[model samples]
Target: MINPALQPLSDYTFARLARMLDGIAPAAGKRPILLSVGEPQIQPPAFAAEAIAAGSHLWNKYPPPKGDAAFLGAVTDWLTTRYGLPAGMLDTERHVTSISGTREALYQLGFLAVPERKNGRQPVILMPNPLYHSYRGAAMLGRAEPVYMNATPENGFLPALDEVAPEILERTALCFLCTPTNPQGRVASLDYLKRAIELAREYDFMLAVDECYAEIYRGVPPAGGLQAAAALGGSLKNIVVLHSLSKRSSGPGLRSGFMAGDPELVGRYAEYIMFGSASTPLPIQHAATALWKDEAHVESNRAHYAENWRIATQVLGNKKGYHEAEAGFFVCMPADDAEALTKQIWREQAVKIVPVGLMAREDAEGVNPGDPYVRIALVYDAETTEEGLRRIAPYF
Candidate 1:
């Protein structure tokens, strides 16, 4: 028998999309263009393949859950350079652990942090309304109350920290904050991250920052949680950051990422994964190590995304409610009826985009903040992206 808590998670975002477009076929003679998913279509660096092949001999070796020394050192060096972290501020062995990807580590964090009760009540897990589904899944399965904090235009598409009630804060066990947030590409400011870290410390809850999109931005690089912690005195207590090679290196298939933060939490997470989760393969870790050490490919990838954004602006800039994203690869725009528009575009132009409403939960007043928006991923090559945008522009 399945746990009753799992019942509400029957339909994931993509599953619902599939069900909605089940019987409807795309326009014939025009090959379908999918802009609904955030998977990058760019080729990862050639070094990735070479590194993997060179390390293939070690594939049979049982992988350690905490990752090997070389991989950890590369990750630490990258983090230090990328975020301008102080030298020796991070003790790799105690502060970092490799996971198959950020998704797995992000989900597992709930189990590591959520307790049976907080402040004599059922523990609460705070997440943005239009959040990654994994956060909700983790909270529910961990027996915590999932509190949806609304992120809407009124709040700059970022959840307002002041709105959360003190009672809820007192009971909160885990809080997930995503910068360059999914669906809406809004980047949180350094001050905002610092405030969040302070809250987690004050309330004595775990702060999990999902920074998977940190490397994909337009102008200034987005501020990271670790940067905030460093500026606030260099202690990583009550905070953890998750990063992935999927968005940064355009290598989603590699399934490599790492979690870094408080030594105590990192130790606990390593123990949990050692016993319960699959360790990242040695071959993949070697490839990821090379990927992290090199930034030329990342720069090339960023340039491609920038060009795609330029194409998007030229194609759809004049449309009502069209706004260029601050960071990340998605173009989120307000629609009169998001679901109807999503289906209409798919049926009429063979252009697929995601309706943001499906990813968000209703607020306490029973309103979904994402009801009026649709999220289109700008993850295709320039030609395909331009074609997709041209097809989608006329409708808006």
Candidate 2:
């Protein structure tokens, strides 16, 4: 067998889920509840179906690698409107490119950023400790040292700029920042983002901001990368923001997203994809364009997630770490030990939740930042989440 490190990291999250539920048959007496994966249970917008159906003829032809003109323009318009970027902030001819979804684009970026060395030393890829798994995989595939910055509670669950020690930034090749961060459901404020962008420019490393969860906030709209770019003199020079229709439109199956950044990098990534990536299928592109043009459906999807969070806080309100999720769908609640609680919940209540450790890794520091907390993705509807919490409160 090949070395395990050569295998994909994503498989670990699910494989652990499988083992946790091993040989455990679901109780026929009660329906099983899943609060593990982030896949949204809400119905996707109707426009997606309509758009894809209208573009049925395009299915017969191979999608052009760079994306169709309409798709590209819809993408640029979205960047402008959502982040309030000035006109021409992103020149589509050089600045924008499409991917099947964020995963591939994000992972591929490691290959684009990491070089053999910086000052004759192995380049580093900076990532928040409890980060999206793809970011780590990107660093490994790029052959750069994956430097983990603890995004634990003390840091507001946000990576700290001042704490990045000057040495790491100097040797850094790329830094991945996921706002409205996964599991934690924390958003990096605008000041935080601007500071990170400034650090990236000073260190001369790429700033990759994963804003896939940008559309699902609770109270205030999120401060996105494009907004940060506008503040940083309206340039997409050191920034790369990745957005997807999956979370934005609850259309993960469509597998559509785009990246806007330094035109040189975007063009390079698109070129790299041309030889390897099956371009976002034209039908999917059409659906995505329609999604970008219409915000009504996104508002509805956002409401569903917001409702689920409200239901979560109502049930688990008094429990430790139960602040209403500010953004994204996951809730991070204090647990004695995530692995133990995960199994206990499945065996006793038949409710499936992922251990926070599965979503994070232990660095040389011997601390998995997300440990002692289980990540509950409120992926179901109001009723289902309420029931899951009702059963969950007992175990915690």
Alpha carbon RMSD to native, model 2: 1.6
At residue 37, give the lDDT of candidate 2. 87
lDDT of 1: 0.91
Model 1's TM-score against the true structure: 0.99
lDDT tens digits, residue span 1-396, model 1: 877888657656888889888888898888899999999999899999999999999989988888989999999999999999999999999999898888888778778899998989999999998989889888977889999999988999898988899999999999999998987889999999999999999999999999999999878999999999999999999999999899999999999999999899889987887788888899999999999999999899999999999999999999998888888999988889999999999998999999998898888899998888999999999999999999999988
User: What would the TM-score be for candidate 2 when compared with the true structure?
Assistant: 0.96
Estimated TM-score per prediction?
0.99, 0.96
What C-alpha lDDT do the candidate models reach, one value each?
A: 0.91, 0.84
lDDT of 2 by residue, 1-396 (tens): 766665656455777679767887765577889888899888787878988999999888988777888999999998898888898887877888888889988888888877889767889999887777889889878888888888777888887778888987889989999988887878888888999889988889999999999999877899998798798798777888999988988888888999888887888887787677779889889988888999898888888887887787778888766777678888888887788888878877878888888777787778888787888888887888898889888776
Question: Clashing residue pairs, candidate 2?
Answer: none
